[model samples]
Target chain A: MKRVEFFVAVLILAVCAGALWLSRPVAAAEPPNTPRAASDSNDGALFTAFVPVLRHPRCMNCHSKGDYPRQGDDSHRHTMDIRRGPAGFGVTAAKCSTCHQDHNLGNVHLPPGAPAWHLPSPSMPMIWEGLTDAQLCQSLKDPKQNQGRNLDQLVEHLTEDKLVAWGWNPGPGRTPVPIPHDEFSAKVKVWQAAGAPCPSR
Target chain B: MIGFSVNGKRVDLDVDPSTPLLWVIREQLSLTGTKYGCGMAQCGACTVHINGEAVRSCVAPVSRAEGKSITTIEGLSPDLSHPLQRAWLEEDVPQCGYCQSGQLMSAAVLLREKPAPTDEDIDEAMTGNICRCGTYPRIRRAIHRAAEMVAKGGAR
Candidate 1:
C-alpha cells in the first residue's frame, strides 16, 4: 500500500514538472513560434525599437489618420487634393492602382509603384499614426483591428507581405525604413518570443 | 498584340503590355483629351470610363485594360453636347481648364448613380477631381444643372 502511494505521489510530481517545463521560455519551446501568454520579457523595449519603423514615412504614409493620405518625407498633405473615397483608394475616376503600377517606373521622382499598391481597404484602415506604443501594440494583438489575425498571422504579415516589404526597397528618391529587413523581422520575432508584451505608456 | 475597345471602336495595337493606357490614348491613338495632371492616381485629371466606371488611365497598364471597353472625354460626345458638357459650359466650371475633362468624366458617373444628387453626393463623387483655380462651387452647380438636364430627358 505504501509502495502504491509513493508511486502515485511520483506521478503527480512528474505531471507538475511537465507542466512547468511547457511553461518556460521559448528556448525549450517546440514548433518554434510558441508565444507565451504573458511574461516579464523586455517586450516594451522590443516594441519601442519597432516604433520608429512604424512611424517611418514608407509605412506611415499609407496608415494616415485623416481621410486622405500624407505624402513624402516631410509628411506633406497629398498635393493631388484627393481623399480616401468609398474605398481607401481614390474615387471611381482615380483608383489607387491607376498610377501606382505593379512595379515602380524608371522615373525617380514619379509615383512609387508596387504590386496591388493602395492604402489599406476601408474595412481595415489599420491607422498607426498618433498611436501610443501601448495602443499600437494592443492594436496589433487585437484581432478586430489586426484584420482578424492572431499572433502567428501578424508575424507572418510582418515577415512576408509584399507591400510591407516595400519599406526595405522604397524605389528611387525615397528614404526607406532604417532597420534592415531581416533585422526588423528578427526583432519582431524576438518581441513575440518575449510573450508579445506591451509598454506601460 | 493588345486589343481594347475605345469609344465603341475595337483597337488593336502592337506595344508593350506594361505600357500605360494613358500614353496609348494620348500618344499612340492620338486621343489627347484625357490630360495627365500628377501622373499619379491622386489627381482625377486622367480620369476616364472603363466599363461604365471611372478609372484613371494615367498608370493603368495596357495589359490589364486589354479586352476592356474604354471611354475617354472624346467618347462623351462627338458634338460636345453631353448633358454634363452643356451644364459645364452653362455653369462656367473652368478657369485654367486643365482638369475639366476629368471633372466631366467623374461627374458623368455621379449623375448615372444618383440622377438627383444632393450636395453630399456631389461632394462624394467629384472629390477626386481637383481644379487649381478652386472652382469647386461652379463644379457643384454644374453637376446639379447636369442632373436636372438628365432628369428632363438625357443631358443634351
Candidate 2:
C-alpha cells in the first residue's frame, strides 16, 4: 500500500512539472515588456522629432482635407474662388498659372509662385489637419496613405521637392518654417533611419 | 507702361507695377464700382474679374493684371440687365448695397461654372464676399433665381 501511494505522488509531480514547462514558453514567446520598451523609448523619440514640422502651416495649408487649399499663415480660405480642381490647380478660367508665376514675385504681397504652382492634387490631399502625433506618424508610414512613398521616397520628397522647399523660401510677408531646412531634413533622416516609430500619444 | 484690357477697351497706365489694381481701377481710370473695403485681400469687396474669373483687386498687383482682361462690376451690363443683376433686384438682395457689386461679381463666376448650382455651391462661392447688413438669405435666393433665368434661355 505504501509503494502504491508513492507511485501516485510521483505521477502527480510529473503532471505539475509538464504544465509549468508549457506555460513558461508561451510567456517567453510574447514577452509584454519588449514592445512597451521599444515603442516608449526608441520609436517614440523618432516621432517626437517629426510631428512639429509636419504640423506647421506650410505643410498643413496644402495637406488639408477640403477641395480648396488654404492661403496665408492664418490658413484663410484662398480668395479668388480658387478650388483644387482635379489636378489641384484652379479651374479652367481660374487656373493657378493664370497668376502664380514660375518664381516668387519680387514685389511684396503678390501671389507667391512655383514651377508647378498648385496644391497637392485633390487625389492625394494627405490631410494632416488635426491628427494626433501617433496617428500622423502611422499615416506617414503607411504606403497607402503616404502617396505610395517608402521611407526612402518620403525622404527624397521632403528634401528635394521644390514646392516643399518653398516653405523655407516662402516669399515676402510670410515667415519661413522655424527649423532650418537642412536641420529639418536631418531630423527626417534620423527618424527614418530608426524605423519611423509612432509616439504613444 | 502697364497695359491691359478693361471692359473691352485697351488702356496703358504709367503707374508702378507694384501698385494695387484697385488704385488703377478706382483712382487712375476712375472705375469706382470696384469698392475697396480692405487693403488686404480679406474683404472680397474689391473683387473683379481677371479673364472672367473673380479676383481680389485690392491685393493683386497692377503688374499681374498688366496683360490680363479685367472686368469690373460696372462692366457687367450697360443698364444692369445681366441675369445676376436682374435677379438681385427681383429678390431684393441688397440691404446697404455696399457689397452688392462684389457679390454679383462672384455670383457671376458661379453661374458661368454651375448655372444650376445647389445651395451648397452658392455658399461655397459666396462665403468670401461679406455683406455688412447680412443680406445672405436674399443673396442666396437671388442666385437661385438667376440660375432659373439662365436655364430658361432668356437670361440675356
Candidate 3:
C-alpha cells in the first residue's frame, strides 16, 4: 500500500510539471530591424496602443454601425442624407470620391481624405463603431476578418498604408491623433514581433 | 462677460471665448447636440432658447446670453417628452436628424411664446432653423400639430 501511494505522488508531480511547461508564455520571433522584448509580444500592451486610433472620430465615423457616416466629433448622423452604397461608396450618383478626393483637398472642415476614401466594402464592413479594445485586436489578428492579411501584412498596412497615415495629417479643424504615426508603426512592429498574440477578452 | 442659466445651471463666462458656444458646450461640457454648420450662423443649426426666445447659438456670444435663462435641447425635457419632440415623432420630421435638435429647440420657444401660433408666426420664428433635407413642410406641419396638442392639454 505504501509503494502504491508513492507511485501516485510521482505521477501527480510529473503532471504538474507538464502543465506548467505548457502554460508558460511563448515569446514572439522578432523581425529584422525590430526590437525584442518578452512583454512587447504580449497581447495586452499591443492592444492598448491600437485602441486610441480605432476610437478616433475619423476612424469611427466611417466605420459606424449605421449606413450613414457621422460628422464632427459629436458623432451625429451625416447632415446631407448620404447613405453607404451597395459597394460601400456613396449612393447611385454621389460616389464618395466625388467630394472626398484621392487625397485631402485641404478643406479645413470637410471630409478629410486618402486614396481609398470610402468605407470598407459592405462584404467586409470592418465595423469599428463601438468595439472594445480586446475584440478589435482579436478581430484585426484574424485573417478571415482582417481582409485576408496576416500579422506581417498588418504591420505593413499600418506603417505604409496611406489611409492609416492620414490620422497624423487629418486636415485643419480636426484633432490629429495623439500618437505620431511613426511611433504607432513601431508599436505595431513590436506587437507583430511578439507573435501577434491577442489579449484574452 | 455674460451670466445665464444654461440647462438650468447658472453660470458666467467671457464673451468671444475663441470658438462659438456650440463648440464650447460640445468640447467643454460635452453637450454635443447643437451642431456646427455654416459657422457664420446662416444655417440656423445652432438654435438655443435664451429667456423664452430662440437665439442662434453659433453667433450668440456668451455676453449676449448673460443674465438670461439659456436652454439647450438636453434641457427641453430629460426624457425628450417635450411637446415639440412628440410632434416631431408624430410627423417624423427628421431625415438625418443632424438638424432636428436645433429645430426642436426653436419650435419649443415658438409654442411657449405664441401658444396659438399661425403659419406666419411659425415661418417667422422658424426661419433661422435650416433643415438641409428640405423637411420644411413637415416641420411646419409638426409645429401646428404640437400647437393643437398643447391646446387639448395633451402636450407637456
Candidate 4:
C-alpha cells in the first residue's frame, strides 16, 4: 500500500510538471539573417505588442481588400466612388495623392495623408484586412508575397518605412496607434532578431 | 435629449437637446449614413423619417424629434434590400454617393406613405434631396420604378 501511494504521488507530480511546461511561453527562434538590432526571444510578446496598432483604424482603413477604402473609426466605406487601380495607387482619374498630400491636410472631412500616400501595391498588397496575427506574421515573412523582402528587409521596412510611421501621426480627428512609432519599430527589430517566429494562434 | 424608436427598437439619448437630430443620431448612436451637407438644411443630405414624416435631420433638433419614431439609413433594412435600394441600384443613381443615403431615406418615407407616388408628388417629396452626381433623371426614374415595383407587389 505504501509503494502504490508513492507511485501515485510521483505520477501526479509528473503530470503537474508537464502541465506547467506546456503552459510556459515558448520563445521564438532567432533567424540566421536577423539583424543584431532585432534579436529577441519573445515572439508571443512581440505579437501581443503589435495587436492594437495592426487593428487601428488608420492602418485597417487603407489595408482593406475592396476597391473602396474604409474611413473613420466606424470603418464605413469611403463616401466617394474611389477605386483602387491596377497599380493600387487609386483610380486613374483620382490618384490617392490628389487629395492626400505628403502630410495630412488637417481637414475634418478630407483625405488624410502620409509622405507615401498610396495603398500597398496590388502585386504585393500585404493585405491586413481580416488577417489573424499568426496569418499576418506568416504572410509578412514570405519574400515573394511581401514585396520580395527578407527578414532584414522587413525589419528595415518597419523601422524606416514612411507609411508605417504615419500610425503615430494620423492627423486631426484620427486616433493614433497605442504605441509610439519608434517603440513599435524597436519591437519589430526585436521580433525579427528573434527569428520572426509566428506565435501560435 | 429625446426618446424615439429606431429600427423598431426604443432608444433615448441625451445631447445638446437643441442640437440637430442628425448629430445625435450619428455622433451619439454611431449611425453615419445620415450625412451633413449645408447644415442650414438647404441640402437634404441629412434627411430622415421622423414619425413617418420625411424631416431634414440637420435642422430638426433632438427636442423636435422627441417622442417621435426616427429612422436613419441603418434602420431602413439590415441588408439594404429595400425596394428603393433595388431601384437605385437598377438606375445606378450614384456618383460620389455622399448623398445617396439621405436620398434613399427620404424616398423610403415617401414610398411608405404613398405606395404609388405620382411624378408630381415625387418631385414635391424629393425636391429636397440634392444629387451632386447629376443623377436627378435617374433618381426620378428609380422612384418611379420603386413605385411600380410596389404596385406589382414586388417590394420587400
Per-model TM-score, in order, reads 0.77, 0.68, 0.47, 0.48
Order the candidate numbers by lDDT, best to worst. Answer: 1, 2, 4, 3
DockQ of predictions, in order shown: 0.27, 0.07, 0.02, 0.02
The residue-level lDDT of candidate 3 at A66 comes to 85
Model 3 C-alpha lDDT per residue in residues B1-156, reported as the tens digit of each score: 556688999776654643455766777667888888776445667777667666556654455455778788888988978878888999988999988888887788668767888886677566656787999999999999989998999977
> Model 3 off-target regions past 4 Å?
A1-43, B1-156
Clashes of each: 1, 0, 2, 6
The 10-residue segment with the lowest total lDDT in model 3 chain A: A92-101
Q: Which residue pairs show collisions in model 2? A: none
Judging by lDDT against the true structure, name the best candidate.
1
Model 3, range A22-66, lDDT digits (tens) per residue?
A: 885332333434545635544577657666877888778777898
User: Using DockQ as the measure, which candidate wins?
Assistant: 1
- Local accuracy of candidate 4 as per-residue lDDT tens digits, A1-201: 999999999999999999987885333233334554322535466656666777788788878777666788888876554556567765422345333545554446544667767777777777777787878778878887678898888878766887878878887788888888756766676566656767676
Off-target runs (Cα >4 Å) in candidate 1 are A1-37, A121-124, B36-45, B77-81, B92-99, B113-137, B151-156
Q: What's model 4's lDDT at B92?
A: 88
i-RMS values of the candidates, in order? 3.3, 4.5, 14.1, 14.6
When summed lDDT is taken over every stretch of 10 residues in candidate 4 chain A, the lowest stretch is: A25-34
Highest TM-score scorer: 1
